[model samples]
Target: MVVASRMLFRFSIVWFVAVVSCFSQDSSQTYEVYVSKNLIGTLIEAKIISKDVNSSKKILYHAFKEIERIDSLLAWQIPTSEISKINSYAGKSPVKISYETYSILERSLTYSESSNGIFDVTIGPLTQLWGFNGDEEPTTVPDKKAIDSCLKLVGYKDLILNSNDTSAFLRRAGMSIDLGGIGKGYAIDRASDVLKRNGLTSFLFNAGGDVLVSGYKAEDQNWTVGIKDPRKEDKLLGSVELTDKSIATSGDYERYFEVDGKRYHHIIDPFTGYPASNSVSVSVIAESAERADALATTVFITQGITGWQGTSDEEFLIVTNDLKNIFSPGFKKKYHFKSIK
Candidate 1:
């Protein structure tokens, strides 16, 4: 879980969309910006191009409300959340959950299975063990025995969902689930739905590093989003022009603690119960923010682009731990990325 203060730092190293022009030369085509600092443990920013100011403000309000609802339901840190109930009832009995929570869990399980447990939501135990659960940061590396113990409780296969009762059960007593890897993307998608339903065609919605854009930023120009270089604070690897698409980036810089010149990030491997070291950063572009978020984490945990076997609809840019940049053929062809260094 990213805290509000750390989320600010996370945004600096993660990707950022180019700011939409507030005032268009044609006064009739200006955009309204909406920003919220207290939602989803990170910044929520949206720019909508609308003619009716009242309607757009109302729509933005509802969009944020939708995100808040999700955070209340799925946030593991919240004791009243459904996720907490499921964790509390682990190995005891099934805990009834809302449809939204159940659906996201089901979606998470799909990614877990497809990624061969590389993207497991059952990594909650490992997260807590390493002190990366936003409660505290680890001063020293955890013992191997402790990591192994946590690994025992970290398997997506042990999570069971019952559609008939709309319930979830964790087979092990200490097993837990954290939706941090994919929840923001789901929320962003839901918010995007709200804007589209209100008949807004052009918008840019970003929560943390999860971004979804629609229509155009201007008359004929697509939105340009910068992909920050994970190695540098104020540098970008490049930018991509996108419309009607979603992009997400996961990097080692988001949350981490250093000990003896080594950095251990929050993106832990469920199998090893330690930070995944194959990739320094990974950015994924997909049709939906949900998929992009999951894929970004999945590739980072696996072997970056070399190990990825994604579908036709997906493209990726991976910065390996060796400081090498790997771009999927489709990504290179479609984005036409130029060197920014």
Candidate 2:
């Protein structure tokens, strides 16, 4: 429950974020490219374009290495991972964790409390009950009794964080944290920092479609991104131009299963232990990919634009299953979305 509560607090604008075709990179020779052996069950590709081609190759290697390092530390599947250790000691005692893990959990708890439990990190119990704890094919419908029992162990309130001691404790045993939702975005953010510090300026870091662009893709053109169409296979609902920003999306169509005319997806609702059905998908644009990722899931769980309006400081677009499009007034004002109809 400790790690689970921490996971869902960040927006997982998963699957809604996609890349569009750009001009062919004839200048590919002037870039540093890196693809890592480390896999987080999520795709991570980062590109750094450089005026000085010689330096970029080494930069790319380290950039990808940095992402792999973060993935190793955060992935819950790894038995020796810190999150795994936390779950192992659940309800037993506080286990001292790294400063980075402690920091993430602290912010996670704050978001959980502030979101009124809508965005919870301790949702592991429910996620497991629903069979969302694994990366295999979408799971079958769990019995309602199983869900209720798991719900008893779920809540962000149960994840206790001690800043002074740099540790965390789960109020109950049998609870685990899954960072699958927000960890990708967090990894992207950290990798981006690594790039910036190494003196690379213009590039795109796409970690499993959660995209963050820095500066213009070209002299006068910003990076172009697209949001997937929930109803259509392999088609984009619309595209947006971005520079120095991060955009993420969460949709019902991403990962799910259907049986007897009913559908179940991975975005397990922390409260109901079911897939959130309020919106077909939600896209969030924020200054940080981490925030955008977190907002995408939180807003979808909020159900619609109206529910998200009063609290969110970021711009968003919510597409509900009914085909109604909801855009924040701020989004409508600052950005021009193409004719999506």
> What does candidate 1 score on TM?
0.89
Number of clashing pairs per prediction, in order: 0, 15
lDDT of 1 at 2: 65
What's the residue-level lDDT of 310 in candidate 2? 33
RMSD of 2: 15.4
Strongest candidate by TM-score: 1
Scanning candidate 2 in windows of ten residues, the lowest lDDT window is: 12-21
lDDT for each candidate structure: 0.87, 0.76
TM agreement with the true structure for every prediction: 0.89, 0.86
Q: Per-residue lDDT tens digits of candidate 2, residues 130-201?
A: 665575675479888998888888877888888898999997997777776678888888878887899887
Give the per-residue lDDT of model 1 (tens digit) for 1-341: 46977998777655343233333344475665555556878888888877776778888899999999899899899899999999999999999998889999998999888887888999898888888766666787889999999999989999999999889999999999899899899999999999999899899888997899999888898888899899998999998888899999999996888887999998998877889988899999998899999999999888665446468978999998887899888886786666688
Clashing pairs in 1: none
